[model samples]
Target: MKRAKLVIGLLGIMLFLAACGNLNSSSMSSSGTNGSKGTQLTGQSTDSNYEGVIENGKYVTSKSRGVSNTQDAGNQLNLKSFEKGLLNVSQQEFSTNKYAFREGQILTKKVVSNWLARESKSNADGLNPKDNGSTSATKRNPIYLQQLEEQDYMIQKNNKLSLGGITIGLGINSVDYYKKTQYGATYETKISKAEAEKQGKAIANKVLMRLRQYDSLKNVPIVIALYRQASDDSLVGGNFFAYSVNKNGTTKVKSWEKLNQKSYVFPIADSQTSPNTNDTTSFDNFKNEVEDFFPNLSGVTAQAQYTNNQLDGMNVNITTQFYSQTEIISFTQFLQTAAQKYLPAKVPIDIQVSSTEGVQSFLSRSENGKKFTTHVFNSY
Candidate 1:
């Protein structure tokens, strides 16, 4: 009888262990934590959802962290503009006052690479169209898709952080550049605005469907924006053309809202006319005054942003040959006065004064502000 009881106890223990193993496997599969580094969260209040969850006194980072995930390493300007522009676009749907920000934890590097590749027999997961044996730019199919970026939002409930929303930025190529043969001249394939919009929307729909397959993302609200990337030789980055929002548990994007946004470099090129004449004149006046004040300046230029054909903001970069601290300070003060007097008072303006050595001073004014705030960097 004693031997039989011992046997029964051993069998019961074996059954319990096996059951626990199954439970762990199920949890891993559902949470999508298999081989993931996992997130770190500190159970502390951030005072506001916009501030996001705090981890070790800092905002929580994504499971797949760092800048290695971003594509397009050739143009640093486009990369910076693309990332910042996406954040601003996201603010329209996921307001900072309500939602907390988090770097994307979903869509790993491997997943993104697959989605960016051309579809073929072996790679059914690829999103790009398969290559046909065509050398002509007019007949050849362009790589419409360029880069993918993801941002996640979180909401705190019952002292635990949960995924509240997500935003994805699809960088579509306006011009596809490639070489047909080894050591051959490069060719350019231009994609029209209408065609880009159509392809972007289609790709967005497919992305939504794939995302819904994951249990964690099935019911999460997602905002997807279509960004038209600037050409390789473009001086500035392109703007987002449209966006769509998919509500919880929905896999399809019903409709898209158009965005009327544009960016222009100061002193409009001879080939391209200014969109806003008054704004252009104001900037030109401001430029002339600053240049007159500092004759030893290397160059002065500005990048302006427009929304609905109205000036939204301007960033001025002043390159100087002066090195004296006093000279830098005086120029910065003069820039402030000139900017206020000549530049539009309705929009924010940022001025950076620099030399070959590095940044010398900075000046800025808030929208409709009466005064400018000045800061001069100190060298050790």
Candidate 2:
């Protein structure tokens, strides 16, 4: 077996070297932003184009784009949740069938940083409230807006892609965490839900007005979603509570719609039972079945998404002590069977099986689908 592994590694290296010969033949295109042009290697996907700097001839990344000057208050979980949730919301207004998705290019880091700063003598264009001298949480105005994200939607017309719409996500802090001095203890200023929504809408209006100043964005419809960020200590990120859209030629947001979306960790405490008891019961049965079969399993956990008080989707993670390829494959097959029998059939389900070596297998089923697609990674 050791000799076979050595042969396989050598063959892999040979194949990699052979593929390098085609590097010069790979086509490259020009991607322009504002007035500056950047090189974009022809990507494999024809569905949409990326907006960030190209990397490694095959990937696009934002690292070279620079970071926002605003102070970050949320963790990685919050950032991921905030961005993913915003994209989901945008899809409803800008359907994938009609519009091509693109990362935001209109709001540069410098522009976003300026908008997040407080209004002052030199920074008169700042969107945040002017800071008072007081250090008291209640007396001093808090930084309600933490981050801003923009997504652009493009439509192809006569072989050219043109901007069709824009979606903006506002991440508002629920609790402002700050300290008075370098060595002082941190304090929390909690903002009520109602207050956050109110301030978010006001900020959205201001953002819309500011965006309208640009000639290219004057006639494009814009969708704005307000997200209430979770506290600094929270394990799960916050949710988007409300959203509004401004139609073309409009500079003000007139109406808003409330979103009743929530996410819960599996096996929730009895005191904090979810309103959808059926999903909770189903997930509990599935967890029990898998654990009963694999006694040496580390744990099985799930993050369930609920929309309008109904189960929408779920992502389950299973950690195990097994590492052998055959064992991983067997466990994955059994888990798929158990999931189909116990989990909700109408909701999309994604399951990942992992060990100390990282992910070993994946299983997923789309909404209302009866079959699950399974894949077990090759252990080299």
Candidate 3:
């Protein structure tokens, strides 16, 4: 079979991800003052619109966002739909990596909850009563991580889950409530990409460390990535910050790695009308359909670009490890058919299929006027 080139840099450390159970919850509480400065990342508070600021290694709500009525930004995300969507993806067959994938999903949610709780308690200064006849102040509502879109695993050529690499996408938002009134809700933040990356990495580390508490996951290599939420309904993952734990007996978490993508942005909602050429959302839909049609495949990672809001180029790569030789040929034919059916006819089209042996085949096709050209590389 044709050899495949590995693009992602795998850390030298050995990492494993196992279901976390019966682990000591003591070390898991980074919710303390001396634990993590993440508490300073409190959501909007009740006493004041501003929650707190980080001053000299401390969280102070005295600092403001330069707005008085900034207490409420928008509506709280109804997590019901988000949770249901996540559960749907989780239900899909992830081959040998299903459990770890599921754990990553749950880990992100739990850590967010814990981080918020810790921040609420640390903001005690905001909860103190005033001598001017003011009622006792309540703590700020907790911040949360929302819409964990999907978990992408790094599978080895042996058709086994790679212990050293994993990636998941999610959104960050905060809980805000009225001080005088009792109504409360959560809203997305307007923090810049830099600030969001910083917070995302911090939150990811919190979750990974907790995951490490389990004896099974102690030696496993893992990477957690966080992304800002999208404005639409689809699970279109976007720019992110990756957090990796230190290797070789080191207890420190490494610095965050910022990943930026400049491509056509597409709406999340799936549609049949002229595939949205403005962004890659239509490509994502095609990817979902491919997975649904091919049961032998675990997942498909597809991306595309647009120029002048027109289809410019595209690439669709899928891992087909467990499929037999017969299936691979059929899958290749399916791609050829798909390329002509969905992708722009005039643009260069590349569809790559990789297996446990290596890249099994590569099919590229393009058209000029009414004529078409095709190229195929296969190893059997």
Candidate 4:
């Protein structure tokens, strides 16, 4: 259950520029202003029945819901636990640019995580040296202290820039319990959004308050966001509200002006789906085509939500039990080309590949009305 960090590019923009190497130059055919048209993919089908099953327009898989009691008893698909998914760390849409915190998204996550963990421990233990007469602030959480120490060492080792401001994304996990019905059926109980938001804000406030104690932290702006960890493994940003402190040395937190409501759209969420049956029908075909194209894959999970005939985002997660590195790289490139060609220009695409080595995620988005793919984050 190790947590992985995603590096945000400069200007608070999600890592959009890509270096996919000169991978598939000749194999893919460009179809003018749209995406690639013709491409032959090669993969031996692990499931013999799936070989010709998809060709008849049959779907072998169902939409993957994050919550399941029996299907995946161990919760092996949990993205956060494995640090599997790629995050758009430079979520400029969640915070206000009017307030400055050294612009780059790079190691700012360090600042947020360290500051929050320290703050949480201090408040819980009544060790606020400034407020109380306690001489030792050293009794803070060991995890936070370790992280801060590592961050400081890295800064000195690499001559890295000092931590300015940071956008802290907090996913307040909900505790689930089984409730037995009269018919002996059990259902999972999730905490209400209201309660989750309250808890998240309480956590964020503690982080912000402790952050104000340090001279360096006080000067830079801090945006604290609260998101609910959905059953579907998607991080929904701007759930209740996000808070930020001014550039000046002040602990006063104010609400962030901008919120990315579109980020909340998920495949299971009813409101987010397109009313046009054609969109769903078209997407189903696309899903089948992609899965059929990769016959050797152990399994494939694809999710997409369309609004008004436009795609907000499309995610394709695949697990190749065994494959050569060259084949994996070529497969990644092929998928990228397929997405650019088949999907709308504005749609954000996330392509994740999991293999024996680890998980690798590639994110793409539309920047300045131009399609841009995020640099791949390697889980080395």
Cα displacement (Å) at residue 187, model 2: 2.9
Q: Please, what are the lDDT tens digits per residue for candidate 3 over residues 198-286?
A: 56666565556655675545665444445444333323323333434344223346765543432332223344343454334446556
- TM-score for each model: 0.83, 0.80, 0.36, 0.45
The full ranking of all candidates by TM-score, starting with the best, is: 1, 2, 4, 3
| Model 4, residue 25: C-alpha shift (Å) | 38
The true-versus-predicted C-alpha distance at residue 371 of model 3, in Å, is 11
Say which candidate scores most in TM-score: 1
Against the reference, the lDDT scores of all candidates come to 0.74, 0.73, 0.41, 0.40
After best superposition, candidate 1 residue 259: deviation in angstroms? 0.4
lDDT of 4 by residue, 1-380 (tens): 11112324422355532221221123321112223233211111211100110111222121222222212432333334222111222234222111111222233443433343323434543211122222232321111111111011001112222443555445553433232336564444355566666655665666667767766666655655554444544443222234343455656555544333233232234555544455455455545666677757765555554333445566666677645655666666776666555544555556677776677545455423344353444445
Residue 139 in candidate 4, Cα distance off native in Å? 32
Tell me how far the alpha carbon of residue 359 in candidate 3 is from the true structure, in angstroms, after superposition: 33
Q: Which candidate wins on lDDT?
A: 1
Tens digits of per-residue lDDT, candidate 1, 67-124, equal 3323534445667787788878877777654455677888776787778888888778
Model 2 pairs whose backbones collide: none
List the candidate 3 regions with Cα displacement exceeding 4 Å. Answer: 1-118, 122-144, 147-170, 173-189, 232-237, 241-250, 262-380
What is the Cα-based TM-score of model 1?
0.83
Judged by lDDT relative to the true structure, which candidate is superior, 3 or 4?
3
Cα deviation of 136 in candidate 4 (Å)? 38
Residue range with the least summed lDDT across 10 consecutive positions in model 3: 62-71
- Candidate 3 structure, TM-score to reference: 0.36
Deviating ranges (above 4 Å) for candidate 2: 1-73
**lDDT ranking from best to worst?**
1, 2, 3, 4
Q: Can you give the lDDT of residue 180 in candidate 3?
A: 44
